[model samples]
Target: MGEVTTSLQRPVTNTGRSKLVRHVDSFEIQPPAPPSHNGVPRSAWARARRRVSRWHRPYITLLLLLDFAAAAVASLIAIETFDQSRAGFYNAEQDPTWFHTVAFGLLPLGWLVSLWANRAYDRRYLGLGPDEYKRVIRAGVAVAATVSFLAFATKTDLSRYTVGTALLAALLLILLNRMLCRFVLHVVRRNISQAGHRMVLIGTLPECLEVYTAVTRNPAAGLMPVAIHVTDGYAAAKGIETPVPVYAGRDVLALVREVGGDTIAVCGSASSEPGELRRLAWQLEGSGVDLVVAPQLTDIAGPRVHIRPIEGLPLLHVEEPTLSGPALLAKNLMDRVAAGFGLLLLAPVFLFIAIAIRISDPGPVFFRQPRVGHEGRTFRVWKFRTMYVNAEDRLASLVDRNETDGMLFKMKEDPRVFPVGRFLRASSLDELPQLINVLKGEMSLVGPRPLPADDGDFLGDVRRRLLVRPGMTGLWQVSGRSDLSWDEAVRLDLYYVDNWSLAYDLSILWRTVGVVLARKGAY
Candidate 1:
């Protein structure tokens, strides 16, 4: 018989209970207690830290207030725009009445309610990626559709222009407000101590390390790893060093409690059995802790993953990647229209670049290189001449000075690059000529970067990158450009391939503008 202890009037045992606790030989560690400060032993400090770390409520409330204010402002702007346009219209004689008051009041309320219905305020979707923005857009569309249906069915005297303008304004304002909020939150998180939820990672050493790297890299996501609970025998078999303490334990609930972690991230290798996970969830009930299970799937996006619980068993379904759907068709159409417009708008800039290149060195205005394109076909990828005419002849001599890894050759300050070429590369102006490639249907406004045709033999399975037309700027360009390792570049490209969406493309394009302005990771 093993000695047991009681916690909160419930017996804690190593076995024979709803929660299976198979204890190992690892020593138990207690959670951090309050320290004495100026003759005061403040035990409540730990609790207060935990409370502050859970910022979901306050964050959501702030967003709600911002949304309401945006709605009111947008409504006023829409009404003013409509009134100015319809100065002599028949409805101008109809004085402001209860209808106006009711409309103003109900529109914001409907917008708020729709956002809630779409789970826009959910903590899981907040502070990360484009999910929150997608939800907000969906909510706005839902409200617009509902309002249109009501007006059409009830024959209400409503201005379609006013309604449409107000909704669009509200959407843009809300997104802007949310972005500002995230920026402020990120600043606070970086400056403040104990700003994020304390998380205990449970998995094998490698798996735990992987999750730890991801969480630390995106500190804005608000998951701070306090400790790691490795699977039995992993620590002894393969020793590893981490910023946080590591323990070998089979009882996840006990480890979480000991570490005082409000979140438990179980990596793919930790809980292989579904029943074990279900039991752990049951034991964690009323514990005020969250359980996040990281699946084995890599490079897959949220939209492709679906979970269906049937007969008490959860089944994960992944949709295959396809580029022939209506979504891809819409993407293609947008690419052509935007690329054509960009070329027309920037024709003067193009001529200026051409003249600069001509004056800087006697060479063609545009440089063409054979690049692997969609379906492994080859195309002439065009760019403004950013190098000397004999750049290729000097390539072999500079191979030893290559700055980037694997098949790509990158040099921060190569002898073959002209003075004007450095400016072009630094500001990414040289790639502007690829807009023509996009317009000609050999590429897209957003996709994987086209690799040199000679490197095709090294791609292996990564040839999947050729499924869609290469892009002028892609995950590689926006993320780190010449600074990224070959593996990292491939990973990002595959991630984009696995999870391409119009919203994601728009997000990347927006980020690209900022990256270019900041001049980060560019040669």
Candidate 2:
């Protein structure tokens, strides 16, 4: 990712300044005539936008209805299960329908209100990231707090069982509903080309191409790059081929209109002018097109970034990574507790696996190898042996057959691995013994995957990964594992190191279950 140092006011250099100025001036002098529609509607793009708009509203409405239904059903089930007859402001004996009415109506309404207040239903959070889940959880807490406060204020004998059960069930149902909805949306976006925002990407050649690749790769994000408008005329003139149709940056609004693009994504260093983005926004004001600015910053999560407005300029402030203090302490505590619990609970499975390995081949059940750990420390990491005893000796002969690059070595079908080993590797069961490594505090349950002690002497930015304990599983494991390029794997590892949070760790752990089960990207 490119680092942004200069302000948005990065001056137009003299190299091609005059030629480009003349080129842009010519556009102002003689605007390209709009393509004659020959009586056809010019609102085709607008119609498509309206169609997408319609889709968004209906989907959100459906989510709302589902939430209401979930809350209502949860309330009903809780009250019925707990037999809260003598609860709430009015007792069931005094007014039989009073508690029922409140449970069925007020509880659901309050839940919806809490969700709305927390922006759980915001479009930005609808189908992606853990923010949606976080918001939902926050809404649940808000509802719980409200209930507790109301009960205390009114001196009502609210049934703890009923309230607790209702909130728990409602949150679960809502989260499940969101997951299903996201799955459906992903499928639709992947299969249907017209399902997402048709975007016109604006940037220099390299930046535009980078953003284009990212957008196209993640179909779940709903950003379809329809065209590219290069801000660097020299790069465009070099006849560099691009994935999307290229255009001059001077006529950006015209290009979007021609390409039916409903979104304009401005990638890194799109302009030399300080107010170019603001001007672009002004140009898009009445066009019903979204303007998105992609900063050079990458891999930094939202929680670490903040925008501070002074006068008319908005400055981006990034907080330093939380490498120490209460958060890391909490993470340490969580890792030890979870690792201890997992070891005890999975002892029988571990024993079974050891027996299988013994039967499959004559070698040690556990493979312990020296790995780089926190602060450049070396530790013996443990894993179930998934290769023959002579695997290391055969490595020299198979060096040319390595499928992956960089300090790592991988092969889809290594001759050294036994049949049972293949199964264990694919299912990631071989790594189960690393619970011991985690328990010993040599590794975390989530962080950068430790490299072999001889991978290479860590240097420069790569050395940052050693600041935290290596992990049994991490962002790289959940993302692509062996399928990822060496550089990409390193980048993911660095991202994990830089932006680690307990929530992020938990999310990775949750996704790791799915990734392992699906055997995606596993050797």
Candidate 3:
């Protein structure tokens, strides 16, 4: 009875015991079933966390809230302005209740929708270039058109004056709000640690270096280079040394992940094949990574470039630069009218400057220099004399001390300038006499700076600047004037020549005011 009981408790043979041992071994070797919390995998939770962190939620939320508030305030201001204007002008059937509902509620909603449709608040556009402002203006115009159409369709006796005034006021207010937001964004972007997208550059050493340099210089662009994947050769071969680590490999996605980069910027087509790029783009989708392909073409604005897709190839259609047309005619008319009005308004100030210059030195109150103008024609450019009579003779002596780029002669503290001349140069009052040039049609309100006839090195593509009349204040003046390098000045001039428009001229003129007030790059 005891033996029978032991046999029942123990294994029948070594086979049973070995089978049990094998089962235990299997349980230990089988990879501990991926850590689970509440039946969900740890890997899934990690992915969700990464995705949530990648979103610029704070910035986007704040910007959206600000825009909504701006729209509300704009609507209120527009309503008030319309009421005041209507009361002062045309007598219209006043329906306060209806007007208030439409103006404050309907109008703001429509305007907001229009702004969204036009991509006014796009992350790519905000805080960079004039795209955001352009979108705002486009939306405003669209809203105005829609309002006009609705007024006509409904046959509502809406006062044209009231509608027009409200639209104008709303447009201006929106612009002001956007400008303020842009200023704030600029401040935020100045700090590298606090702002910008972390980018992993993928390109040949030279191409990547060029892009890296531009990104570093323009912090407001919000692209910060964190790592570089050199495709063609070693960075040393290209004489490029970046603060960021240099990577070498074909696995761009892995490299981006290793560097914690949110963006992958491909500099030029040579960086990767079309098939590879397509694959990379596919892999990056849903990965919270932005891919930016930098085309070989540089310094070209968006308006001139149009993408035409044909046979699976995206062909870029670059419109030829127009030097003349209706735009030029309008610009000419504006320049004449503005110059005439300015001369009249500034007559007293101009007289004071002339007298001051005459009293300071016994020389001509005005300086007329022969400059190359439109179509390479010679024109006498006018300026309030801010130098001694012997300034021309002294130029040779000061050449060695020139503080500006070699192409342009500039002296911050030239002996040839008298005390009044120095003040005039510093204040840019010396340029006031150019208003007469604008009136005479020898100069424009905005264009490339007129090079002196003696400075004949501006030939070839540089001479494209002569396609339009030289300006009293140009991209060169507002950008940096004497402080800009020769290449930078020429690039700006070329860009202006290639993309001339009334809106662009007006923008430059507006910026010119602020630049002059700041006295940046003056003298």
Best-performing candidate as measured by lDDT: 2
**Once superposed on the true structure, which residue ranges of model 2 sit more than 4 Å away at CA?**
1-54, 87-89, 93-101, 141-160, 191-194, 234-238
Off by over 4 Å in 1: 1-52, 84-106, 141-164, 186-195, 257-260
What C-alpha lDDT do the candidate models reach, one value each?
0.78, 0.81, 0.74
By TM-score, rank the candidates, best first. Answer: 2, 1, 3
User: How do the residues 122-146 of candidate 3 rate in per-residue lDDT, one tens digit apiece?
Assistant: 6777777888888999999999899
Question: What does the lDDT read for residue 380 in candidate 3?
Answer: 93
Candidate 1 per-residue lDDT, tens place, 131-174, comes to 88889999999988988888789776676777788889989998
Model 3 scores a C-alpha lDDT of 0.74
Model 1 / residue 326 / CA error / Å:
3.3
**Which residue pairs show backbone clashes in model 1?**
none
Q: Clashes per prediction?
A: 0, 0, 0
Ranking by lDDT: 2, 1, 3
Residue pairs clashing in model 3 are none
RMSD of each: 7.8, 7.7, 12.8
State TM-scores per candidate: 0.82, 0.85, 0.80
